[model samples]
Target chain A: MALKPYIVNTGIITAIGNNTQQCKDALLSGKNNIGKPTHLKTHWESEIPVAEIKLSNKALADMAGVNEEWPRTALLSAVAVKEAWLPYAEIATGLRTGFFSANTVGGMDLTEGVYREFKETGTVSNISSVINHECGAITELVAKHFKIEDFVTTISTACSSSANSIMMAAQMIEAGMLDIAIAGGADSLSKFTLNGFNTLMILDRQSCQPFDNNRRGLNLGEGAGYVVLMNDKAMAQCNATAICTVSGYANANDAYHQTASSPDGIGNKLAMTQAISKAGIQPSDISYINLHGTGTANNDSSEGKAIEGVFSGNVPMASSTKSFTGHTLGASGGVEAVFSAIAIRDGVVFPNMRWETQMEDVNWKPVTELQTGIAIDHVLSNSFGFGGNCSSLVFSKS
Target chain B: MDIYIKGTGIISAAGDNSEGTFLHEPPTYDTDKLLSKEPNYTAYIQPMQLRRMSKAVRMGIGASRMAMQQAGVEKPDAMSLGTAMGCLQDTEHFLAKMVTQEEQMLTPTSFIQSTHNTVGGQIALLAGCYGHNLTYVHRGHSFEHAMINAQLYLNDHPTHNILVGGIDELTDSSLQVMKATGVYRKANSTEQILNTNEPGSLAGEGATFFVVDKNPSEGSLHIKGIGISTPEDTAAAAAQLDKFMQQQGLSNTDIDLVMSGWNGNSSGKEFYDNINERFSASSIAGFKHLSGEYATASAFGLGMTMEIVKHGAVPAHMLLNGKQPKALKNILLINSYGHYLSIWHITA
Candidate 1:
């Protein structure tokens, strides 16, 4: 039996835009949505810029067509998924539909607000329903609301959670177990995440600059991105426009450290090598690479080394779009996946914003200008997260 | 299509690994309570690494090490793990510190260790196995997802040995919050798990690991097939099981033992009862009584099934039915986690 290819129809909700078109437009224009935090309140608001969705929880809830009491994380997920699935709802229905989503800090925004109240007064008031903040709860909400009755699961591999989710969905589809899968991730900014990253001393007080010598750190962002994957049969029946085919994907652990990638990028090299092999393509065939440039000192340097190791001196045109979107954490993979599909569909590569001096460690430069009318074929996206979770996805023009 | 369970290990509130856990009587839980014992993780983990790992990682490492050692493979072809809560204790710790410390001078250790793939990544790192590595964190069906991935890897590659497991740990804050939200059983309930009328089940945590391969080792249990279904899809699950058995040219009667995830929660137990009514004639056993109710408790069941198939003997304490099959040939392990039902068919 031949392995089935899993294709992505992505939906996105971010500070830059609400749907895929808006995100594409934002990327093409090199618009950065990083600014003062609006939806969330934190003491660091004055010091750091974040890519926050301007809508309030109530507004987002209404947008998702849910009750007012839904958690912000669930609301964001529903909105992104709604947009992603609307075009393919007919195809999704009556199939072996599975929901595999991920979020780093699930429902923590609600929990933080409630904890504050509980701390102030012994009585926990209207925030009583915020208790289903476990890792799988958000995906459960999306699966239940969408009436997806097949294999529903959630991934919480921190920043790389959604990438791993997408990878798992593809593996399942390849195994001929499920017909369709909605795989992606969502994460709303919480005082919890903001503060956690802040405490780690990795948060930049200014805008994030990836692969730059003077880069400070990452700017946190909140949003959700989802991709609807279908088997060939479902695709034929739905006649869905295939934006890009998930030609190759691989996940490997660095096993080097808890939070840091190995200096040699062994895990990253393994993942990239495996993915290229799975795609039945050579490293030279990859035209564009979406680097997991978190703008943090550790990530950019390590990822640069990994890229160099994989492609040697003959590197593909690569850039870290994180300069525009910041590090979206769990949603980064899905978001970048959307960007990757757009890159392939439009045959254009978005420029990496805010690059100044090159890193002294490894001599790698990001695509600095929007290049159009290029014969782009395959785009490789990398997402490396804490716990040495490293993943690479190869997307090709359909 | 031929997969084998060459070796297995488990670390739960019940005990440390398969040898330590299965050799003794099943551990009993207090009514509507979670397990509270902390395993001596230092036995398996280095001190420096142990300093950063959370309970989930510790349990996972302990069980994974045991599985690798028992399988007599220094390094496996691949490593995979399933986790629902990931590292909640670490997540919660970081969250609390973030709020209390006002985001100043925060160490990255907890934040770093709090990912869902830590177990799988750590296992691969410790074992120095650079082969395929992945983590599945879908709730209720995490272990099933991992198993499916393992099967796929086996199908595609000629590699023989694979390490797969599921690990979930309960934190005090998570338990407290779950209790407050009515997802946990109320305190002081005298009702046994299966007989309980309450809506919630007790919370628990553990890790279970298996050394799987396409070719059977000296003492191997054949992993015939695996089936999974989303929440409340018991009919689909049963049908899938039936189809799997039929494809394997086996029947319900051919199954010498059925290990059910009767977690004492109303819904979980109800699902187990449904399976029981369908396979009442088969010798049925339960593991939640020993492992407690967590997303990956089914992993404990898998570990047990591997042992029963290899040893040709069921632990007396795990035997729910007095009738013991003279010689174990086929065993069915069923578990419902989060919102999915997973069935594993193993034959000796």
Candidate 2:
């Protein structure tokens, strides 16, 4: 049986902008949002650069229409989910709408702050409510806010959380289990994540440089992105235009170390191969590749090697959009999925912002400049996270 | 659609691995306190690898290896794992180091093992099974997410086997936090879990794995369907169960056994009471009394249901009612955790 293609109607909220149009304009104008961290205070603020969203917790809570005391993670997620569902709210009213969200750190920002207060004063008044910082709390918040009652789930495979969320949503829709799915991921900047990465020596002190020979490590970013996936029946009822069709997607585990990809990129190869096979397309059919280049030494090299092994000389015009938007962890997959859809819709190739040099291990260079008016029929986006959770999704123009 | 459970394994406070877990009687633990027994990590995992692994990953890999061995397969087509609070031990470790050590001489081990997918990825690497791998961490419905994904994989690729499991570990701090929040019962409570009027239940953790395929193996159990919902409406949940059972072309009478996630609390018991009344003729079993109440306790319930179907008898202790069906054809396992409700159907 032929699988039905799910279309993407994305809602994006990033440090770059609020909506799709503003994000696109920011991307084209080369406006970067890397600056000092104000919403979050950290000891490493003097040394590190982050892509922090300027919105305050109260402002985000107001936008989400939740109470003033809602968890920061909930507020951020509500903003993204509200934007994604506004256009399709009525169609989802009577139908079975499921939500799948991924977050690496659930309410760490709130917990860390409260923990600090407790340590200082030995009182627990401030952070008692945010104690439910586990993976499910934020997901329940979204499900409640959207009034989605069926099949709400959360996936947290580290950085691949959102990618896996999107993949699972597609599988559920294909299995005739759901009619529409709001699938994506969100994560906020927290001292726990920052110090965790910093302790691992993976936090680049300056701006992150992906696909570069001297790329040190990744600079963490925080945001949320979601896409509304409507099945054929739901799409017909709403008369919605598909930005692109999710033709193929596959997830493979590297079985390597906890944080590093395999040197051979076997897992990466398997994911891409399976995705292409599922899409029923040839390797040459892919025109754009959104590499999960996290600016880390291990990721860029292994990902590049994997791409070379698969495509060889015919590598697609690829770039690490993470260079523009710092690795958003769980939200990277959703954010990049939206970007891939934009590439297909606008027929343009976004640049790899700081790719002045390519690694010596692979014979490939990212599309360094924004190339407009290109015939991009298929876009393959890759998201690999800790625990070797590797996933690839192939999006094609409708 | 036609997914068969070829092999299954479990390691929890109840027992070590599959053989030990199934043969021994489930252990009784306090309902309102933390329950965990230290397993000898050296027997299942290498010291070097186990040095930095959190309890969740350690138990998860052990269970996965046991399942693979039972299935007698080198690699599965896909791997899926579910967890609520993923790698909390390592997460807590990293957080403490960051604050105390000032992030100076931090090793990458804890940080690396802190992610939720560490167990699934490690299992893949250990078994050399580089297939579709995913980890779901949706509080109570974590295992359901994995089971649903595994079902979809079986539906898509009928020829392949998928390894799915759910794992959670209780950390002292986390347990303390839950206790502080009034989610756990008082330590001295002596009332039976099913009859208890307490407000909270005990906290425990474990790992359970299943090798699901379209082809039936030597003692295969068939997974029929799964359904999940939140705590917004208990009546709605009961209605959803009715519809789900109807969709499977089965009535409440066809259900021979029901395994419930009754965790010795007033609300939890009430939820099970509603389910039990619906299947009044079927023998009911409770698990959290043995495994304790964790987010992924449903996986333990699934393991217990598999044992009941395989052994053709309800282990004397698990039965709520003395009645046992002559032939076990259908088993409905229901679990509600962290404001979410899930139901799974399995048959032999």
Candidate 3:
């Protein structure tokens, strides 16, 4: 609580952009990365919409400078991690380096292919293909790629997974555990997850309209995001310029249901309120909020009520970047955290994309257009997920 | 900061070690694959809810319940868990259906239960605990990270009682995959596993949970240090162990017992020989012969060591070198899974 972890740099890739600057550029122009995706090969690709990055495994591997045989999830993670590690790599040798990554599906894209073939013919041809099938295996693959062996771990608490990862890295830093931590998460679109979300019947055929009264459901997206965190020692050694200081973060469980939030967003409220308290600030001190508005009926409604419960008056400029990138699932927290960092760095408010009607539960209206040139000191980022996992992070201007 | 292990619960090939129940003689698996000696789910979970859970979730719930009951903790301040491979049954179910049905007319039950954090979520939901919760899945380091997180929580909130555990389950599909990789073999006998000069080890799975209290009124069990290392070569494992010992201000002679992961296989023989050379004076032992080999089997080793400290006797079958130490004090556990090594120092 006393030591503020510094976020020195960030990197991200989504349907709208491939890097942090590119994402900022896309947000300013109000680009919609959601629609019928071209990369994902699914039976519902024609009927259901997604936000897949327009690239093949071969292309992503080439860009990542790794083996093409790796999982798409690992490839995405390597690309963003490489970008995040570039500046930090200078002084990483003198410090204890760590890599904490997150993902939901692991190497399911590869596992399903091999498993399907085995199921069809009852013969196995290369068991090595699915060797990275575990979530941690994917983390190790990318960790090995970066040669970050001082410390390594993976978190998988669903959509809130990477927020918790970022939070964990900061805690480790505050506890004087590691000097440098490259933390975030990655997930690539796969038939396994596509059908899983489809089975839940939460896919919106059209581009998602988050925080809108007529919002049906979410459009699943795929990508990776990462942030380099450093304590004072590493910062001094690296001569790093702080992008932002992590003021506070907290993780809480909804405990209401496995797949759904408590109708009032109890976990969301606790996470936000606790983080604000830990940051030693008032609710009104927040400049903007990057909502976890996944365009789902339950998520937006629950998250909105929780926001109202915490704040007394008019809320600050807030929007859901998911409207532009769609719901990136496991990668959303890191993806949105990068968005939040730049939002404070440049004082920009990304749009909520399309909001025709407001939900009756809350009075605040999401920003409908990109607004820049405003001073932002504090930004709140939300990431809620299945399995009752909910987390929030607060970053203050350094 | 010193933390005490107030209570422990485990459901593994060893036994259902709940309150009023503890493993005295570990059950020997006649088959190569070792499954947990599961308790009646009705004792910990409702019948209706039990049907919905996969075996991993059920074992997690049952073990956590046993730990909470023994510690008298209705709700903990936080929970952190480790599972190398999570919810395999549900993951495979969802994958098989998606592949066979071509993503049509599937129910959400398996998909909903397939999440890695389902056990933690279910436990938190049942306990009505709204505190810090986390899950680690970094192969061998998974359980160690969970332990590290628990220590961090206690460092911040010294009065807090945290629940921490490691869990992994084996499914037929997963076993098939492991078999194809040539590290899995069927059993001849539990005794034969320890002496095997073969290429593979027995497959096993289990759950182990502990109630870690920063301010326990009475306890002897303590965690001195936990460290993880990725050795570039076979010889680097011992070098990392020496560095960790120096970090903890300890010497090889200070350790009275060494519980090493000597899973019976040619691939693991070098590591076993390394452990033997490092701790020649200490009472050397292995648990994979009793608990079998898994990513988080070190959790089982920790639980077994706790039982030995409480009872003040090491089971004859547990000691590989066949020499029981006259006194038990500092016990070290080193587990190797894949390319990772988890080293833990438990003090009694």
Best by lDDT: 3
What's each prediction's TM-score?
A: 0.93, 0.95, 0.98
lDDT of model 3, residue A309: 85
Clashing pairs in model 2, backbone N/Cα/C closer than 3 A: B31-B202
Ten-residue segment with the worst summed lDDT in candidate 3 chain B?
B19-28
The TM-score measured for candidate 3 stands at 0.98
Give per-residue CA lDDT, model 2, range B73-97, as digits (tens).
6678788789988888888787777
Evaluate residue A203 in candidate 3 and report its C-alpha lDDT on the 0 to 100 scale. 83
User: Best-fitting candidate, measured by DockQ?
Assistant: 3
CAPRI tier for the interface of model 2: medium
Point out the higher-scoring one by DockQ: 1 or 3. 3
The Cα error of candidate 2 at residue B293, in Å, is 0.5
Winner by TM-score between candidate 2 and candidate 1: 2
Kindly indicate the candidate among 2 and 3 with the higher TM-score: 3
Q: After superposing candidate 2, which stretches have Cα over 4 Å from the reference?
A: A116-123, A127-129, B20-31, B38-43, B102-104, B188-191
**Model 2, span A137-232: residue lDDT tens:** 888877887888677888888888898888888887877778888888988888888877876788888888888989989988888888888788
